[model samples]
Target: MSEMFQTYERQYQELVSGLKQGCVAAGALNEDQRRPKVPELKTALDEGDSLIRRMDLEARGLQPPQKTAFLGKLKNYKAELTNLKREVKMMSMGAGAREQLLEGGQFTTSQEQRVQLAAATDRMYQTGDRIREGKKVLVETEELGVSILQDLHRQREVLQHSKNTLHGVDDNIARGKVIIHNISRRITRNKYIMAGLIIFLLLAILVIATGKRHQG
Candidate 1:
């Protein structure tokens, strides 16, 4: 994508250079010679316009960061194209005026040309407006996507914390079981000791009573 952008950038620069050269060359020519140059300049301008639109579309398709990076350059290209249009318009007007002067004000072709140029300029402005709106939408969408990813990240953290808490609880339960088992063993041993003591006392009492009866 970067390479493609660079390629477009290079082409646009070349086109602009050629256009400027053409404008200069036309300016140095006689009206008759410059007459043919206007159409050629208009063709270059059209090609540049199309190329810029293509660049805009390509920029739109890029990632947010990449799009951001290209924005300045894109704006610069747009400015350049606008300047080229103005130059072409001025050249056309100059030629038309010279022809009208030479023909004693009988040139209606320039008026029609002006109207067409105005319409084309209006369309260019409308296209620019649409491109701006599209950029706004794209920014909003990128922000929404970032927000969603953050929410997902937070939820993942919560889930991981819950799993760790459950593991701790399991550990505590296992410890409790071991403690209860040890206590139960201690209680059984104590009961056995008490039984042995009781048996010893009973045997002593029997022996004493038997001896007493023999003496009597």
Candidate 2:
């Protein structure tokens, strides 16, 4: 269990790092959802989540199979983060108080109130509650890290089987892309060949006609 906690602690630290980066990146994204840059930022954020999920798997010693599930969850979280970031940005723009719809009133910018509530939530609140959902997620992520280590201890063979399945799918997709690219190249080559042959035949006919006219 000590090993598990160690793994969990490492993963937690990595997640905190990612969260800090995410906050900074969130500021780089457009404040308005209507902007074209918003989608680009969203895509970047989604890709970031993918990186984080893969990193988490490496941290947990879970290997590969679970990576897909975590990736799926990461994608979901990316969507959530995008929405949250967009809302937060909108709030920054002096929009109305009800963008989030989480609580009845608009969120106040009183840094003291925000700090005190945050402290209270950290100290006395159940991590699972809606008010402290982020904390709950962090704790659960640690539990997942421990669970993954234990799983590796007991059911590694089964986990590897899952890993193989996912890897197979990933390989097939890569192979499919290569095949499609080759087919496209072949079709283009054939088109050029056909065009070249048509031009050659036309030139030959013209030469023969000129010789016959000269002989006449």
Candidate 3:
């Protein structure tokens, strides 16, 4: 059980690390795109993807009971990773579409390409807003995760202490049973010895009384 719990702890830490890294990477990607930062954005994206995959694989290897809770946390982190990926995709696509519309030399208001560009920009803005909200949520979840980890630590400590205490109680019960058995045996031996002594005394008195009657 301790081994299982350790496995869970390792997995939990990985998931938390993944969540924080992914959020940070997502923000970096957005900042890069906004400021025309190159290669660094791509580098950050690659690193984030690798970390996310590693954490996911680790999470999948966890065993039962602890696995249930571990998996739940992994799922939540996976969702966050997916959101980050989607946000990146949308931003990249929107940028490409905007560039294409500008290069086509068609500035007409009703042009199909123009409309698509507008729609893409709107999506980009929405994605940005969503990422902002997600960052806030991630911040709040970080605090919550810390509190939860602390709670788990304290709770496990209590459980171990309780288990040790119960083991002591079990040992005491077995010892008490043996002691009681010995005491009962001694009581039985005393009763038999006393009964035999009483019987011998009564027989001797009866014999003496018969002799006295014959003599008188």
lDDT per residue (tens digit) for residues 90-191 in model 3: 444445656677788767766776567557656765676576557556755765686578779999999999999999999999999999999999999999
lDDT of 1 by residue, 1-216 (tens): 667777878898899999999999998987547756776787677667666765776677689999988877889888988988887777655445545555675447986676465557556655755765576567557656866787799999999999999999999999999999999999999999999999999999999999999999
Error of 2 at 53 (Å): 42
Best by lDDT: 1
Tens digits of lDDT, candidate 2, 1-216: 234434544554465456546556656765433333333343344444444544455544544566455545555555665665565355344223223333446545774475455455434423323434554466568758876787787797888889999999999999999999999999999999999999999999999999999999
Q: Output the better candidate (1/2) by lDDT.
A: 1
TM-score of 2: 0.27
Regions of model 3 farther than 4 Å from truth: 1-136, 210-216
lDDT of each: 0.77, 0.56, 0.62
Model 1 vs. true fold: TM: 0.49
For model 3, name the residue pairs that clash. Answer: none
Model 3 local distance difference test score: 0.62
Give the residue spans of candidate 1 off by over 4 A: 1-107
Residue 163 local lDDT, model 2: 97
User: How many pairs of residues collide in each model?
Assistant: 0, 0, 0
